[model samples]
Target chain A: MSLLEVKNLCVSFSAKGKEFAVLDNVELSVEQGSIMGIAGVSGAGKTTLLRTLNLLQRPASGKIAFDGVDIMSVSQEELRVLRRRIGVIFQSYNLFRNKTVARNIAFPVIIEGVNKKKALEKAREIAEELELIHRLGSYPSQLSGGEQQRVSIARALITNPRMILLDEPTSALDPFLTSRILRLVKRVNSVHGVTVIIVTHDMSVIKRVCDQIAYLEKGKMVFCGPTHDYFSEYYLSVSHDDHAAEQLEKAKKILAENGGNKLVRLVFWGEAAGEPILWKCSKGLDVSVNILYGEIEEFKHGPFGTLLVATCGKDSAEFLRRLSGNVYKMEVLT
Target chain B: MISELTRATLESLYMIFASGLLSILLGMPLGIILYTCAGSKRLASVYRVMDVSVNIFRSVPFIILILLLIPVTRRVTGTIIGPNAAIFNLTVAAVPFFGRLTENALNTLPRGVSDSAQAMGVTYRQFVFMVLVPETLPDHILNASVLLINLVTYTAIAGAVGAGGLGQLAINYGYYRFQWNVVLYSVIILVLISQGIQLLGTSLSRMLRK
Candidate 1:
């Protein structure tokens, strides 16, 4: 079973005595030991979904099952216990102002019944891993924002949770710092075999670390699939840009001149864009491969995008069949 | 005369500390509870009740509040005309006042602090004791100082109602007997004590901040 399964979750908030739904009928499945990205614009309920995984935000109606156990049905006592197994790092990096860095990192462990000495020792180890050992004695107020965020991440890891939910972990960070934290998160997931669900607005962050991506829009999961598919799918779903439209117009004119039933448009959704598959095939065969419009973009998983091309002549059908191996879809636009 | 003035000052100090300690012990939690329940639908009724209750207690003038508590004071302390009785009366008036003050200070904490505490998996009770209280320590100290200084004023008024302290000395010798020098000394001592508490609170708050 997946580590986390959210089925038809819904959350509502009453503002000025008017009830409004923030999340509506959202379903998601997170596999064990996999890094998943939750990406969306503001007000899309990305943070709400992450909170539901830890049962921090209760959905009005839905089933959130962690490790095949129904979290929504658990008693308050059980829920507290369940919460310890799922760690959460908030966007605000809320460090207890009265605590030193070491104590802040040890807080979760101490609360879990570990003695203070052992908790602090464990905190030292995690801080070392996060390169924050030197700041152990400093209070959060004394540290820079990046250092405070490091303490927060170290605190989340000290408990050895099964899954960790990060809400915009690097939203306020610079690009360089953002990548560094993303790499750290990737390392934590891979090294600990822990499932991770990150809520972020940065596509580059998702591409850099996430294997699967869920995109939310207006409190709905508009798309959820492999990271590679998200790249191609997102591009496909956007209204056709002027360049692509203009390329299609030219392709239609060329197709009319070619005067054949075999004229076709080809689109590739993977790294095949960097290859010369079309040039190789049409060169040997009696085929003409006219590149109508082609674009390639590097994505998290690998290179992902679509290329548009037109082909015609006797070997066009066979060429199209051979080319289908590299492309996600091949459409005959005559 | 010096010994008598010294004893009156000590009596005022005793009343302020006792009532201040009791008020903080009782009211800080009450305030935190009110803060935790702020805007929560489940605790809306409790919050409103406590809000109104605090407002009512705060509305009563200190002298009248002390008189109103005489019967209860007699039951608790078996007397109502000494510094000890003034402590009880002062605490009774101070609890709701300081409770509201504590609530307001806690409300000024960063919004994310509480959410992060809960997300960290601490229980509601733990959140208050460990996260909420510690995070707002500076604000709490300042609130306590304000409450204590107010208690100083209240204790002086309590002294006028047969509760022996600076107020009683100031009234018996200064007002009733027309000894203007005694009134001047009492005012000076009260002002000095209030300034001392405020200074300590300010330095402690600044030190605790970073």
Candidate 2:
């Protein structure tokens, strides 16, 4: 069953005397013990959609059900109690500058009337998990951007929220820190069985943690499914790097040989991208070679991508002998 | 000479202290109300009415205001001319001035701070006490110092209505009696006092700054 459900959500804003509808009937769901990804580019209303999940930005019209309770129908006093169950992290970190890291993390709990000692203890517990225990007494101004974001995550998670909404929690973070925070998020979900909905442009964030991924385009959800399926379908479209295209074509032919029509085009990079695939393929003659379309380019991780080519050409034996195990392949589209 | 100088300084200080404290009490909240009520987009018409009232009061010169308020001052305090009467008029004058100063101070704060507080479920009263007050503290202190300095000068002008202070001392014992020594000394003291306040205020504000 879905722990949090947003159905028929719409959001609009008024600017310069004209109202513009930003979110158009977006719907999403997150099950308990799952990390759900809402993947979108900037200005795709990803933040607006995330804000609607907790009614931070009240939708123009929608139904948000949390564990079967329609949050929209609750009174203001009751909604505060409901909000306590839903923690939210922002892209900006949003740490209160006047407070120390521990106090900042403990604010939501303190607001809920948790005693100072208890709130600090809870904050400390989450801080240790996020690896922010050492800086609990430091103020937000004293920490780096990444450290502040970790404190924000610790703050949100300290509430023991049934479900948490993370809005680009790592966008402001450096790559190393981003990976660390995402790992912590996964740990929170798996170890604690808490539902997590992360809105982010980082595909690795989805791949590393998310159980399901939903793609949002211009306020509309275009795709929603398991992370592996999301990677199979949409991940390729995002990695239009020339090298990724070459590797993708090769994998297609190999997967198709095994009757794997629904294939996941995994792009390799660094040592993985340059692996000796053709050398291994020399022994397998049944896998013919056909390079229909191939592109290669340098990336931060080196050349990687789709090799959208058929593996069954007349010179297939020669092709297989020439480029043998050095290549990967998947089936051509029917 | 030192004893007389000390007594004169103490009297001047007393006049300034009494007027400044009274003005703050009367003006700060009025300024807050004027700014908050009028500054609101939802209450634009009410804001306009308040704006007109403040403008009318502010446009009148302090000396003229003191003269005009003599009857009201007499009715309120049973005295037409004295340090007490001057305190009443000076406070009345400072209200509109500080009201404008406070309005500008509040305007300098980031709109995000206010919106964030509201979104966090803070009530209007708590917004004022917690968010708005903290964000505007630096500006508020600066304006209050400026208002105190202005009140010091206003109290001097109150001497024209038979009020007693350094201004009266200068006119009564120095200018009228041709004791230029007393007038020169009083003028020097006033300048030194105002300069001290400005310096103290600036340093204190700098110390308070993050």
Candidate 3:
């Protein structure tokens, strides 16, 4: 089940007497245990969308459901409680100048009404995990940017939030620090099953950590799919290449019995999907097959994607003519 | 000569301490007000009123302020010509000067500091008292020291109008009687007093700075 579902979200801002729509009718979802990355250029409304998730900016109109509960329907106190379950880290590492590193981490815990000592202990625990145990007493000015961001991550993690929204958490860091932060985030997701949502202009960040990616352009979601397949040419992949010649001869023989027609591959998901479609197509047509590259992908559910090819003879053409109405070409590997 | 110097030194210290305290107590808040209101687009009208009043007060020289306040001083404290009366006039002049100084110091702060505090869920009041004020403390102290130096000169003028302190002593024995040695000694002591206040202010600000 989806842990968070945002439908048709819209956000706009009026600054200096001009209205700009930052996010327009954007939709997104996160499954129970998946990291989703929202990748966009600056001012593509990635930050605005992340802010809207926690009600930092109320949507002009939309439904945001966290664990199947409508977020906008909750009372102010209840919303605060809900927000506690969704931690947010900022790009600028907004650590309080007057507060020490420890105090900055302890802020959200204190907001949740945890006693000072208990909150400090929890903060210390996370601080140790982030490798900032010794620098807790130092003010923000004394620490490097990477150290400050680590504290910010530690602070977000201390809440044990069900979902964490990271807004360009590594944008200010150098390469070394970026890797360290990415590792920390990966570790957080792997060990704790925390649902992570990151808004980043950095493609490397998207590639390194996200399981699924949603690409936003001009405040609209242009692409939303699994990480590997979204940008890949994967419509044609076939396994069992050793038997490729054998399958091709058999499929060709079957297609020769029928008149010339169209031949198409109806790509289906999972192991159960491709076999039946292929069998049904063969029984219904005289199949002259050109078995291309076919492969099976093991998705979150089960094996998915089947690549096949056929050359329709006369009767197969008639059958192919009927079947061409519904199918997508994965690729022309030949 | 030593005894004479000692007595005059005590009197100078008294004038500095008493008038300095009065100016700061009244002046600091006025300074905060001037800062919060002046040049802030949110409080443009308040800035205008404050601007006009501060200009009027600042335009009047210290000597004239002391002279003008004589009757008002008599009305308030029932005396127009003593060290106490001198303090009243000194505060009147010092507050506007110090307030403007304070406003300028606060204005020089990076706008990001306040904006960042607001984003942290800090209330507007806490932003002012905790972040804004503390961040500007070093500059505020520096300006206050400058005011203290100016007040030393003003205090001597206060002596010309019967507000007796070292200034009265200088004028009566040295300037009036042509005892240039006495005037020279008084001038030397006043310079020392200002120098001491400046050194203290600088060290204290250094300690407070990051």
Chain A superposition TM-score per model: 0.88, 0.76, 0.71
State the C-alpha lDDT per candidate.
Answer: 0.84, 0.72, 0.75
lDDT, candidate 3, A1-334, per-residue tens:
7999999998988899998788888989898778899998887888888888878777889999999989999986677677778767787776666567898788777755679999999889989888999998998889988898888778777878898889888788889888888888888988999999988988778767888888898899877777655433223333424465455455455546553233344454545444545555656565665554356654433445555565555575555544444333333222
Tens-digit per-residue lDDT, A1-334, candidate 2: 8888889988999999998888988888788777888998888888888777767778899888989999899987777677778777777766665567887788777766679999899888888877789998887778988888788777777767898878888777778877778777877877887888899998767766777888888889888877655544543563544655555566666657754333322333336456655445545455543444444433322444444544553445554345523433333243
Alpha-carbon RMSD, candidate 1: 2.7
lDDT sort, best first: 1, 3, 2
Ranking by TM-score: 1, 2, 3
What range of 10 consecutive residues in model 3 chain A has the weakest lDDT sum? A325-334
TM-scores, all models, native as reference? 0.92, 0.77, 0.67
Candidate 1 chain B lDDT trough over 10 residues, lowest sum: B112-121
lDDT of 1 at A37: 96
* Cα shift from native, residue A81, model 1 (Å): 1.3
Candidates 1 and 3 compared by DockQ, better number: 1
Instruction: Give the per-residue lDDT digits (tens) of candidate 3, residues B45-66.
Output: 9988988999899999888877
List of clashing residue pairs for candidate 1:
A207-A300
lDDT of 3: 0.75
By DockQ, rank the candidates, best first. 1, 2, 3
- What residue runs in model 2 are displaced by over 4 Å at the alpha carbon? A67-69, A115-137, A235-287, A290-309, A313-331, B1-8, B22-52, B103-120, B173-178
Q: Which structure is stronger by DockQ: 2 or 3?
A: 2
